[model samples]
Target: MAHLHCLPPSVEPRVSEHMPQIIDMIKQIIDSGCAYSIDGDVYFSVDKFSKYGRLSGRKLEDNRAGERVAVDSRKKNPADFALWKSAKEGEPFWGSPWGPGRPGWHIECSAMSATYLGYSFDIHGGGMDLIFPHHENEIAQSCTACENSNVSYWIHNGFVTIDSEKMSKSLGNFFTIRQVVDLYHPLALRLFLIGTHYRSPINYSDVQLEKASDRVFYVYQTLHDCEVLLSLHNNVNRKDSIPPDVKSCINKFNDEVLVSMLDDLHTPVALSALSEPLKIINDLLHTRKGKKQELRIESLAALEKTIKNLLFILGLMPTSYSEVLQQLREKALKRAKLTEDQVLQKIEERTTARMNKEYEKSDAVRKDLAAVGIALMDSPGGTSWRPAVPLAMQEQQVVAV
Candidate 1:
């Protein structure tokens, strides 16, 4: 079972403190004729509302009789939905005007959101699948209970698919947030999620994740290299101030990208803005001319600040610089433990045995190191060694050792 953390004090919604009042309002609805109580259960009369399907584009008549709609035979119409369900023999229950039973799924959100965010909140959001019975019902419940028209903005994110197929329990393609974070950098995963607009479908694949990882790595590499250069020369001066072309690029990105993000969170456009500073920083670092150390430092600092702020807004910032470095170091040390000079000495001994045509000795040594995590890669630079960890850490580890 997944362990659920209590909502942090900093983030717990302030409006949730009024749950009792919200429940009381729902009780008032039952007292009115609009809602009906049958066998200790309560249901909404959908036919009473004129704008029932505006958000989902679903028609009331088209909704057929089903298990999710109305289970109580006393419901006036199949399209009517439950406000509160009657408790079963051994199910969780809460006391209400209609006896003991839990609130219906849609009713809980309506009550909770109304209790905390007021009669009507600024915005309501969920996955696209919720537009129908879930969101539609919430709207109906809140409007009738509070005598207020519900939210001003309605946002719905798209579904995620794997291997061009819909993710489902039966197909065995469902992935948890923790599972994906274990295999890839969490920031990279966040970037991958934002690579597409929030309202558009996202297809997941190993190739896409690998590409996102590369992009994140590249951005960090540029930032790290720029910091190194700035520290080395404190007096390098900028011959020219911020270039007009660079300024224009920044402005255009802000207008295009920020506008898209503000328009119901167009994450894809926001992600595209990442390229502008990345390109500018790379060019400045590579050119490495016409700038004094102090000026270069200021310029890079400004650019880095901008990128960091934007990334934070997108929820894609690295969790911590120290944590990233520590992980890299630990991975490197594990690699070095298996393949340092000591392991190579054993390999040499086996090679000598092989020269004497003792094939068994050579094979045995290879197997021994393989068991311990040592691996050899033949390259133009001669035989180089790397750990199974990311290649970026290998050089740093070698230097430290």
Candidate 2:
């Protein structure tokens, strides 16, 4: 089982509500002589904790002193970290038994996790950087306050790098989720993230994302084509539908694919399984075997369903049916309110102008529709029009319209 925690927006809100309880716990630890206070501030005594570096394997002597300057000067040992900091002027503060102060960084997670997940929980997870004094201190604080080790498992996800450099806002290489989603489909982004193991660092670049997008689009196109073929043969009975061998193939895929997913979320192996069924579906659609028509239809339907379900689980399904139709309707509504006949006549005129090589007139007509939020695409089959809703408006209108 897995659990997720989204921390409060600011530490101040948590401090205002939980500081008193934490202060009392610290006082109790002090009474036990495990914690000490100096100049109205409190710090945890790392030497008293027996299992201090068990997680990171950094012994006291092996620990290189952090380069960052120490914030407070009153600590007995240089490595002793603050349990509570006296509030500075104009900063958010709560009334504590010690004084008006705020809880230190490490105390919040210990207090909140204990309050919600109880003194003992199955797992704790965060970025790799937190393994240090952050998680180490959390372990010490919770074990001391709750009188039992609170967390059973500690999981840390690796960092994201860009262009062989660590992603950092100060270095100007950081990209937000919203910014990345704007450039490529969300499914492509997810595929890129999962391409590497969760414990390995992920390197970000446009070339990599483009390759991922292409692969995802190929899968989607295969599924879409299979759906179209299956819709044409739905009238066949089960026995007359796809062949027994194809049915067996699909069953095998389901069992193997599901087992992989259930084991440890092995998505890459699951994705690989798709190729076999995709090829089988394509073969059934193109082979024109009159005797196996029914079997082919069954196989096609099962394959399409499998692809759709897997894509949904991966959060990569395309826009919904109603969403696509709504976009179509909005595009139709944005045209000049010509009668059906008049619209047909305009389309004919535009077609003729293009046929006659009247490039300026053809361009003008396309621009006219574009101004009203419709876009036209020219393909070998014919012209197709879609709504040109601004990207920002598309998200808002998808739900409302």
Candidate 3:
């Protein structure tokens, strides 16, 4: 997680540590009469809150359809949930106004959040499955605890699923972060997660992850190329003017990335915006027409700046492009189950084949290398190689464990 720069929260308070505040919150909910006590157990009454189902859009009736008949019929509604549970024979107990009991699961969030972040806050998030009984009960309890208590926004991210079913251990389909990062880069996983919109379900497959890994390598590769070229010609050419098309591509890419991100965090569209500018940069660096242009260096500089800035906003930029490239290549080599020496040896064989006028043999070697993600670039100087996105044989070639 640190490799991807996802930081920990500033506050990490536990519900047990905040028992006084939790008890105080239960007292408020009870005072509001939004809750009821029975035999020292407290449960929030859904009947008291008319806006109980507002966030989940599950009507009170809709929640009761498939539920098992309530064992404890003392509850007012089937959807009503525990605020505090009376201590059983052998459980840890906290002193509260409702006797020796501990906080229930739902009210712990409400209590802790209200105490720390206050009753009303900006954003709350949870899985879609939590919408019905968990979050609905929270709203019933929290809003009634204090006047004008509310959450401004509730963001629900889609579940990561496999074969159209939610990824689960009992289902025999679950991939952990440690298992995934062994086969692919961490940023690749992060990129794949954001490739789809936040609200849409994204399927998890070896194939999809491979594509994302390739995309990450490509972006890092392009950045490395631009950096090298920009440094190679540090002095900008004043005699030539920047091409209008370069400027336009930069503009469109910038606008699309920002606009798409701002519009409900539509990240997939922002990701698409990367293709045009990347193509232009690569074209300028390698293509014949682009090399002959008067302002090639100027164009590269502009595009690189635009790309680097946008990548920062997307959290896609690595601390060092060269390091990222090297790391990804190492991972690719592992995926292919081939060492660096083996790859170089193949390149040598290909070079010898081409030198001896064995075109078929050379082509065959190139194809084999490509199958393992080694891309050979033929230049006037020599046949150089770079790592491209590896083909999806890693599932078999490399065990994720």
| Model 1 alpha-carbon miss at residue 299, Å | 3.9
TM-score of each: 0.74, 0.70, 0.92
lDDT of 1: 0.66
**lDDT for 109 (candidate 3):** 88
Best by TM-score: 3
| 136 Cα displacement, candidate 1 (Å) | 0.3
lDDT of 1 by residue, 1-401 (tens): 12111124423443235436545766866665567888888888888777888888889877777755435568898778888777798887767678877777777777767656777678788998899889988888777776765688888988899866878889898998777755556665666777877788788875565456546656666767776777686575545455565567667766876797777787777777778777877877766562533345556666777777776677656655445533433333443464256766875777687789998987787666544444454445644433242333333312000
- The order by descending TM-score is 3, 1, 2
lDDT of 3 by residue, 1-401 (tens): 77665667768888789998888888898899888999889998888888888987777766543356545778877667788999998999988888998889898888888888888999888887787678877888889998888999888889889978898889889988888889788888878888888888878987777778878888888879889988977675544458888888888888988899889888888888888888988988888887897688888888888878867776777889999888888887887788888888988899999899999999999888888777788888877776665544444322120
Best by lDDT: 3
TM-score of 3: 0.92
Backbone clashes, each candidate: 7, 7, 0
Error of 2 at 317 (Å): 4.4
Show the colliding residue pairs in model 1: 15-116, 16-116, 235-293, 236-292, 236-293, 237-291, 237-292
Error of 2 at 131 (Å): 1.3
The local distance difference test score of model 3 is 0.82
Better of 1 and 2 by lDDT: 2
Residue runs of model 2 more than 4 Å from their true location after superposition: 1-16, 24-33, 71-73, 232-235, 239-266, 287-294, 317-401
